[model samples]
Target: MTVADVQLFVTSAVGGAMVGETVEGIARYPINLRYPQSWRDSPQALRQLPILTPMKQQITLADVADVKVSTGPSMLKTENARPTSWIYIDARDRDMVSVVHDLQKAIAEKVQLKPGTSVAFSGQFELLERANHKLKLMVPMTLMIIFVLLYLAFRRVGEALLIISSVPFALVGGIWLLWWMGFHLSVATGTGFIALAGVAAEFGVVMLMYLRHAIEAEPSLNNPQTFSEQKLDEALYHGRGPARAPESDDGGGDYRWSAADSVWNGSRFRGDEPDCRADDWRHDHRAFAIAVYYPGGI
Candidate 1:
């Protein structure tokens, strides 16, 4: 017999058997097996079974078929309707970035994928990468908005640029505090930094306004008001702008703006030298330090 004839005969004998008898539907009842055709149950027994082909010849099932024991996957997984395998990492002491980096390096060095095969990273690493990409687009936009608003408020490019420069200083404290609290460089941390930068710009604007108001409220620049450093200090102490001085838990005020002494003393309204420059250096340096130091207190 041919392979096809033998295959069909063996398939009918082994798999196509059906012995039927009536059983209980709702109430219990006895049912007897009408035809118990259990001869083709085992593979080893089926090998000895004889098959009658179309050529009127009898042959054993083993003449056409090869049967053996083997092992295969018990379960399979898929992604997007295509077969896939997953590798998971459980990080305890290691950071996600370094782990993912090392894994990718190892994969590139040791594993050779066939054509049409690909690999991708997901979970927290993927989320972080996406957040960083968004920050790359959003951070510059945020800074530009701050710059434009500062320029509009101050009506001077130099002043706006100065205030904007304080932004990085404002973020330092937030970043340090987040790290101390076991927070990584995430989207939430980045958002906090952006908000803090705005606050820094607000501080700069308020300080500038204080100086402007004090100068405007003083006697005219051409009139030349005579005042010593002590009087100028008093003016700065009392003539602060709309922003109230930050008070400690003990109700004392912080003297962060005390560096304004040189600025008040060297003002044109105070009738100092036209060439005299205020301690601009002191303002930026102190503001940066304050910005970096204050968030922890909050």
Candidate 2:
């Protein structure tokens, strides 16, 4: 028989009779099985299926088409309505950005793409790029806000600028600490640096304010009486500072305390009296406050 005649006969009679036709929605939540499951469960069973019937003009599937069993991809993937496959490369002991950068460079140098095929570096690299873009805008905005707030607080452009300048110094220490701790600069690290900058700026402002107050309230050495209580208030902010001088370590009549002796033994009172250690004074909040406020002996 001719190829078309054989094809028509085999499709209609033998294979169709054995395999049966698939019907959808034949029953509610049920599959309609015209043939048993064992009919074509294996390649051997499929090959042994009857392709010819005795009563009809004889035809065989072998005469019409070539059918050879072989293995193929279990599943296919598509992206953007086009067939695609992923080749994943993982990073260990290296940064994702640098790895992706080197990959792009190498691919550009050595690899060639076909007409319909393409490649992309995604995952962490894509996320990092997005984060960097956001930070680019956020960093400048944060700095502007800090400058404006400092200017409002200090009421002087010079003081604001000076305080803001210390932010970088604070960031240097933070960056170094991060590096020492074996951490890469990420969003969290940037956030911590921002916090550090705020604290550094605050300290700068406080120091500048104290210096300005001291300079404004300086007393002349010519007349001791001219240093009134008002001048003392101006210097110490209305008795907020030390009320009494830190005593000397020496009781050698009018002898003075050495820096080392003061730090080691603390201040001494009268002869043969028990002394408070410098370490104790440091730990005691009241003693610390007294020492800081009164650098000179009363």
Candidate 3:
């Protein structure tokens, strides 16, 4: 691990769990070969052997020697790589330190060189990680609050949940759009995402609110019409079985009558039918109308 140590960092990687974040395979070749001092003077002489330098320049190893590369006939004839060979020499005396230094330089020269080793995770990384966790947690909780708000505001659980679920696509789109704009999501972007969640829900909420009403408003022969209590009882009984004359309008003139076989619903002001008492019609019609129109007290 000192200046006298010659290491060959071997260098390719396929894939692994951390494959995307890390240099595929962390590799290094360490050797202790030393050469005659004569080869240091001439670039041609240096290039003559299996030495591979990133740039072909004369190198001195008073305390450290440089790595060189050869991709010519001599190296090919030497049965190195098909047409190239990687070469390095050791500088004696505490060569480990020098070797590490030279290796650093070598890595700098190799384009797209992935790091071969790791010391430890950085504090910045940990900080960002904690931020990420908080953001993840906040996303769901914020969504939950929005859902609750929707429920309270709309007075219907189904429509509220639907609005909350719709926010994810908005979130995803915001993320992608930010990426397209080259905005690395930092603290500011995290805040923006929260805002986007609310905004996104509005998209669904606006539509959802209107949609529920539209659906509810659909004609229902089942839907009850309001009527005066006088005919209300009459309508209820006659509904069970028909044939009843319309009573005095109660002076209200609101005696529009629709009969369900079981009940007059809103009007049964007066009549002679079994169980067809006036009370039955008025009570059932009002109750049924209330149940249908604003059920859930909505």
Candidate 4:
């Protein structure tokens, strides 16, 4: 900003859309930096000489917001430039609309109202701050809803706790990954957090579902007619137990199928359990095989 002879330093294509290299080459034809050019009829090739290096990083629409133009604003304030002639005020801290309003006032009141080019801007801090606050409120409520869902899906409180606790850990890992990749936490980052939450709970849901299926099949546990300790430890912590546990019916001599071993195989859950003369409920392998491992178990 030049006050006396300050012709207000202006770069035509600094942030404008019309600043293309091809267009500039065409506009500045017969271009010579150090040497005189003998203009030929053919289009002039730009003479190579090092001048000022420009910043070439691209800024996307997602990274910017709030661009406004006002009717009232000043370009140059005084007729003759003085020490106090140049005014660069951060009027945004006040009534934001007034920032532009003040600029408009300057132009209307100033002597040099015929100034050529002035300022260009994109994005606003206040608007971004407000939007971010709204999302912060939304994030916690969403996390709470997920916690309720986990609690309802798994009857035990401990199971829900385990799943919910992992939420922060997973998010931290994701943030670290994105940060290392040169990405900042922005509006898209909120979406990423939501995606991670669902994925983390998916594993917890599958584990709980498998445990439920095994519990319903065990006859020796808490069945329609029996209450025994045969499946006490296995049901408490499933899939991690011993391979060949005592089958519930024949007092430590009966063989049984493990659900976890054959979950993907489809052979363990063959068919409905068969009943005996005594009406004792048991995991019948004959029925199990036909039902679980039927024709081409998919």
Model number with the top lDDT: 1
lDDT of 3 by residue, 1-298 (tens): 2333213311111111122332336964443334444643455454433423356543333224454665755534322233324344443433233455565576667745335522223244446667878998997899889888888888988767656655554455445444444434454556655765675455445444433444344444225774344443343333322111121222113222312321554344321221222222332332333222221221
Cα lDDT tens digits for candidate 1, 181-265: 4544555556645655665677766656665566566664215467455555555555442333431211111123323442566
Whole-model lDDT per candidate: 0.58, 0.53, 0.43, 0.42
Q: Please report how far candidate 2 places residue 12 from its true position, in Å.
A: 17
- Give residue 83's lDDT in candidate 1 (0 to 100): 81
Better of 3 and 4 by TM-score: 4
Clashes of 1: 0
Better of 1 and 3 by TM-score: 1
Clashes of each: 0, 0, 39, 13
lDDT digits (tens) for residues 128-221 of candidate 4: 4566788889878877888888888777777777666655544554455444544344444565466556654554454445555556667666
Choose 2 or 3, whichever is better by TM-score. 2
Q: Which candidate is the best by TM-score?
A: 2
TM-score of each: 0.55, 0.56, 0.32, 0.33
Pick the winner on lDDT between candidates 2 and 4.
2
Candidate 3 lDDT trough over 10 residues, lowest sum: 9-18
Return the lDDT, model 4, position 35.
22
Local error of candidate 4 at 171, Å?
A: 2.5
**Global CA lDDT computed for model 4:** 0.42
